[model samples]
Structures are given as structure tokens and as C-alpha cells.
Target: MTELTPREIVRELDRYIIGQDDAKRAVAVALRNRYRRAQLPEDIREEVTPKNILMIGPTGVGKTEIARRLAKLVDAPFIKVEATKFTEVGYVGRDVESIVRDLVEAAIRLVKEQHGRQVRGRARAQAEDRLVELLSGATKKRKSANPIDILLGNRPKEPELSPEDRDKLVVQQDDVRTRLRAGQMEHEIVEIEVEEVRPMSEIPGMDVNMNDMLSGIIPKKTKLRKVEVREARKILEAEEEDNLIDMDQVYTEAIDRAEQHGIVFLDEIDKVAGRGGGSGPDVSREGVQRDILPIVEGSTVNTKYGPVKTDHMLFIAAGAFHVAKVTDLIPELQGRFPVRVDLKPLSVEDYKRILTQPENALIRQYELLLGVDGVSLDFTDAALSAIAECAWQDNETGENIGARRLHTLLEQILMDIAFNAGGGDAPEVTVTVDKEYVEKMLGADLHRKDVRKYIL
Candidate 1:
């Protein structure tokens, strides 16, 4: 984070998103500000707050992708919640405060995984030893004398093995350990006791979990089940890892991480900001905005982990605003998100770049998927131009869903090929997608046109 400046951040974003430089720059600066704030003195740091961003854009225009990728880049705790999913304070069981709780949970998961990786070596060794014992039957139960055995002239007794016998058992255990380490016993079935964690009862629209409240009160139930050696290793390793990390430390660090670095992307905020008669659902929408204001304006939300402050956590709210204008939101909520960026609709050229330029390009993804079945795909440049033109024409003529139209058109073109190829019995073949192939496959399915003017 310290190494990535706003300029470098925008450069990284350009690799995935073709256009929308304004939205990208806005997020980059906001992210850099968080890092800058961290470097300030205690008093000054407390005074500094994130300049929350409000994104006004249409759907499928990289609004969610920009925020999601930014969080992944920095490994920040991030969650996306639709503003409409929440309601006014009193109408439903869910309130705006649950966002904080969910963010805290995400932080805990992220931190715990990091700690798990650190302790995996020790945990793997421990789990391996336990698996070896189970495989070799070296671990035993105490013997008990039985009346039936006495009546049959054979009495059960606890055996005190001689040194030679114990040495032989150790050798057998070492052999088992060697084989287990080599994965030679992966498919071998072993009976192991696994504890069952019952899910906490849930209420509709409620975030309260009873499992946290019953931490030490109830005993966990363990049941023995037969499983392969591979599955047993994972279960044992997870249990060992849980024992290695400190819960109190995780809670403290997670709460701090959530308060400082959390990103709550409030998507579809226009739903709450939609114009209404102010008598029906619009009233509840107004109430929802008022409720979200305090949190955005900095408030401490109590969570199961601990109380988390939203003062420094950055927010990026996005809405298509097709019907409702940004002014429809209550002034308090609108003021909380001061930085606003309006993303432009994607052009035909932008659609072409989206298909082939990103690190995870849609075309490459399809090629890889088909490659699994020995089907090689080659997409010609003309075919790309044709596809891009079709996507743009569809968007212009019908609902402009931005770049999402590409996905739908591509699916329509590839449906037959995908279903016919992946049987594992077919020979390896190459399917070239050219202009004529795209036209023939999508003839009349696309907007009927005598001349395709946008084709490059």
C-alpha cells in the first residue's frame, strides 16, 4: 500500500478496465489518502476521515469491478451490500448496522487465513503424526477385564508390552508415517472422530447469532466417521491450526483492521434515492438514508467481535440512477459521500478491448474452458470487430447494459459448440471464429441490419 501511489494505482486499474478513467482516478486518490492518513500523528490521524465516493453510472460499467479489484489489490476487508437490501429502522428486522458486523466478519476471516498460512508447517506435521497413528493402529484404547472372557477361560487384561514389542510397534509406525508423507495412503479409509458444529438458528432479516452467545456453555458433539486419508488430513490440520492461533489476538486485530481499512461498497443506492410520492415505499427509503448517515458520518457499531468505528473506513456508493437522481437522497446521506464520479458508457472499441485485453479476458476465459476438452479456439480480428459491433448495436437498440451485452452475445454464439465439444470422447479439434461464422451463427438473432456500419 505504501509503495502504490495514486498514479500507479490508476495504471494498474487501466489493465482491467479500458475506460472510465475518472472513476478509477477517484478511487485511486481515495485509497492513497487512507495510506497518507495512517502516517499522521495520533491527534491528526483521528481528525482525518475518508472522503467517501459516490459513483453515478449505469449497470455493467465497471462500477462494482473497480471497487472489488481495488480491495483485492490491497487485501483489505471489503463487502458489497445493496442499499435496498436494508430498510428503515423499524419496518424490518434488518438495519444498516449489519453492514459493520459483516465487515468485521470478513476481517476476521482474512486475518485468520493469514495466521493459518504462518502456522501451516507446524499444523501439517502435527496432522501427519496423528494420521500415521490412525493408519498403523498404534493409538489404542485401554483393555478392560470381562466376565464373559473369564467364563470362557480367557481373561482380558491390560498388556504391558516388552521392549522388543514396543520397538517393533515404533518401526511399524515409522513405516506408516513414511507412506503417509509420500501420499501412498491417500485413498486408504480411516475412521476418525470429527466434531459437528451446529449452525445457529437464524431469524429473517436478523443478524444476531446465538452460537457466539453460547461459546463455552454447550459441549460440542463428536462422531466417528469413515473417510479417506486425504480428507482426514484436512480436518486434523484445521483443528490443529485453530489450537495454534490465539482467538483474543485475532479478535483485537480484526476489529482494528475493520475499523481502519474496511471498505463497504453500498451498491444500488439509487433504489433508496428513487423519486417517490413520499407516502409509500419512498418514506421508508428516506428513513433508510437517514439511518445510513450516522454510520457514514462516523459512528461506532457494536459487533460480536467488538465495537468497530467507521470513522476512517472508506465508502464507495454506486447507483445507475436511471430514474432517481442523486438529489433524491436525503441531504445528510448525500453530504457524507462528498466525492462523486460519473462513469461514461462503454463504446464499441471499449467492448473489443474488454474481450481481449484484461489479465483475465473473456475470450481467454472461454478458450481455457473449451481447452479442457481438447477444443482449441481461434478468434479472428474481424470476428472480434463483428462481435463488438453486435454488442454495441444491441445496447443502443435495446436496454443499454453496457459491457454485459458482450457476455450474452458470446454465450449465444458458443452455446452449440460448448455443449457438443466437452464429452471427453471427441477428438481434439480447432474451431476458428471468423466474421462469417459469427454472422451465420447470429444471423437475425442480432438486430437485423443491411449494413453493419460499426464493424472495423
Candidate 2:
């Protein structure tokens, strides 16, 4: 994150998303500001709050993608929730506070994963020791049917056994250790006792923290089961890893990370933009916005882990306000998101670039998919232009779905080729898609006025 400047962040985003430079730049600067804040003195740093951004754009124009990619770039905890999925307090739907709780959960998971990598070596060594003990015990039980032979008696057994026999038992145990390390006994079945943790109940409207506490207090049940050595190693490794890490430290760092660098993307915010009638769903719309205002402006949310502070967390809201404008939102909520970025509607040229320019371009993706079946796909320059043009026309004629139209257009064009790629009657080993081939598949439909209804 410290190595990534604003320009570098934008460059990375360009690899997956085409166009939307204004939105890209806004997020890049916002992310760089986070780094800048961290460098400041503690007293002054606490005063600096993230200038939350509100991205106004149509759907499929990279609104959500920009926020998502920015989170990945900085390795920040990110959660995306639609505004419509939440309702005001007293309603049966999810409350807005769940967003913060969810973000904390993501942070805990991320931090735990990092800690796991750090302790993996020690965990593996410990697991190997346990596996060897299990295997050794199994070997001893097979050799002697007497339970007393396997169990330690008050008297020493060394005096009863001949020195030669004792030496042979030592060599046998050493050989078992050697084979265990070599993975030669991975398929050998072993009986082991495992503690089973009861799953938490999923009762709607229940406080998540209470459920967590209840589950923690419940005693775990243990049972014996036979599993292959390889499978047992994995389960024991996870258990050992958990025992090696300090959960108190993990929780502290997770909370700190969530407060300082977390990102919550509130999508479809337009759904909550009321028409100001203050009746029916409109009342709840305005109410939900009011509830979200405090969190965006800075507040504390209680989670099962602990209370998470939202003061410095970045909130990037997005809405395709085709029916309602930004002003329809409550004034307080709008004021919290000061940085507003409007993503331009995609054009035919943008569509062409999206098909071939991005690192994960649709054309490259299709080529790789077919290549796995010993079939190669080649798209001529003119063919790409025609496909882009078709997508642009469909968007213009129908719902104006922005860049998403390409997925439908390309899928329709290659449906037959994809279905028959590995079949008996597949195309040639090398298949080229030219302008003529595209036209033969879609030209008639492209000319029809009712194509939008069917193509979409």
C-alpha cells in the first residue's frame, strides 16, 4: 500500500476496467490519502477523516468495480451491500448497522489468515508429531491384543522384555517415523478422537453477539472416527494453528484495521432516495438514510468481536439515478459523502476497448476457455469492431445497460461454437471469427427493431 502512488493505483485499475477515468482518479486519491494520514502524528491523525465518495453512474459502468478494485489494491477489508436490502429500525429487514458488523467479520477473517501463514511451519511440525503418535499407537495395538501391553503398568516392562526385542521395537518405531515423514503412510487409516463444535443457530432478529456468546459457552462433544492419515493431518494442522495464535491480539488488530482502513460500498443507493412524500415506502426510505447518516459521519457499531469505530472508514456509495437525482437523499446523508464522481456512459469505442484492452478481456477469456479443448479462437480486428457495435446498438435500443451488453452479445455469438468445441462435430482446430462470420450469426437480428426484447 505504501508503494502504490495514486497514479500506480489507477494504472492497476485500468487492467480490469476500461474508461471511467474520473471515478478511478477519485478513488486513487482517496486511497493515497489513507497512507498520508497514517504518516501524520497521532494527535493530528485522529482528526483526519476519509472524504467519503458518492459515485453517480449507470449500472455496469464500473461503479462497483472501481470500489472493489481499490479495496483489493490496498488489501483493505471491503463489504458491498445494496441500500434496498436494508430497512429502517423497527422494520423486519436488515438494519444498516449490520454493514459495520459484516466489515469487522471480514477484517477478522483477513487478519486470521495472515496470522495462519506466520505459524504454518510450527503447526505442520506439531501435526506431524501427533500423526506419528497415532500411527505408533495403532501399530502397538495390532502387535499385541492384550490391552495391558498397550497401557503403561506400575512395573517397568523393560525388565520382562529381552534387550534384543526392545532394540527391535525401537527400530520399528523409528521406521514408522521415517515412513510418516515421507508421506508413505498417508493413505493408512487411523482412528482419532475429534471434538465437534455445535453450529450457531440462525434465528432471524436475534442479536449476533448473543448467539456468539451462547455458542462459545456450549460444551463441544467428542467422537472417535477413522480417517486416512492425509485427511487427519489437515484437521490437526488447523487445530494446532488455532492454538498457536493469540485471539486477543487478532481481535485487537482486526478492530484497528476495520476502523482505519475498512471500505464499505453502498450500492443502489438510489433505491432509498425518496420522492419526499413521507408516506408508505418513502417514509422508510428517508428513515434508512437517517440511520446510515450517523455511521457515515462517524459512529460506533457493536459487533460480536467488539465495538468498531467508523470514524475514519471509507464509505463509497453508488447509485444509477436514472429516475431520481442525488438531491433526493436526505441532506445529512448527502453531506457525509463529499467527493462526488460521475461515471460517463460507455460508448462504442469504449465497448471496443473493453473487449480487447483489459488484462481480463472477454476475447482473451474465450480464447483460453476454448484452448483447453484443443481448439483455438481467433477474432479479426473487424470482427471485434462489429461485436462492439452490436453491443452498443443493443444498449442504445434497449435498457442502456452499459458495458454488460458485451457479455450477452459475445455469449450469443459463440454459443454454438462453445457447445460443440469438444464434441464429435466441432469446428476446425483453428477457428477464426471474421466480420462475415459475425454477420452470419447476428446480422438479421441486429437489423430487427424488436431485437432488444430478444437479445437481452
Q: Which candidate leads in TM-score?
A: 1
Q: Per-residue alpha-carbon lDDT of model 1 for 375-435, expressed as tens digits?
A: 9999999999999999888877667799888889899889888999876478999999999
Q: What's the TM for model 1?
A: 0.91
Where does candidate 2 have its weakest 10-residue lDDT segment?
138-147
What stretches of model 1 exceed 4 Å from their correct place?
141-162, 203-208, 274-281, 448-456
Candidate 2, superposed: residue stretches over 4 Å from native: 138-170, 173-186, 202-211, 214-218, 276-281, 423-428, 450-456
Clash pairs for candidate 1: none
Q: Report lDDT (CA) for all predictions.
A: 0.87, 0.86
lDDT of 2 at 32: 93
After superposition on all CA atoms, what RMSD does each candidate show versus the true structure? Answer: 5.9, 5.2
Task: In model 2, state the lDDT of residue 251.
Answer: 91
Write one digit per residue (lDDT tens) for candidate 2, span 292-364: 9989999988776778899999999999998888999988888998999999988889999999999889999
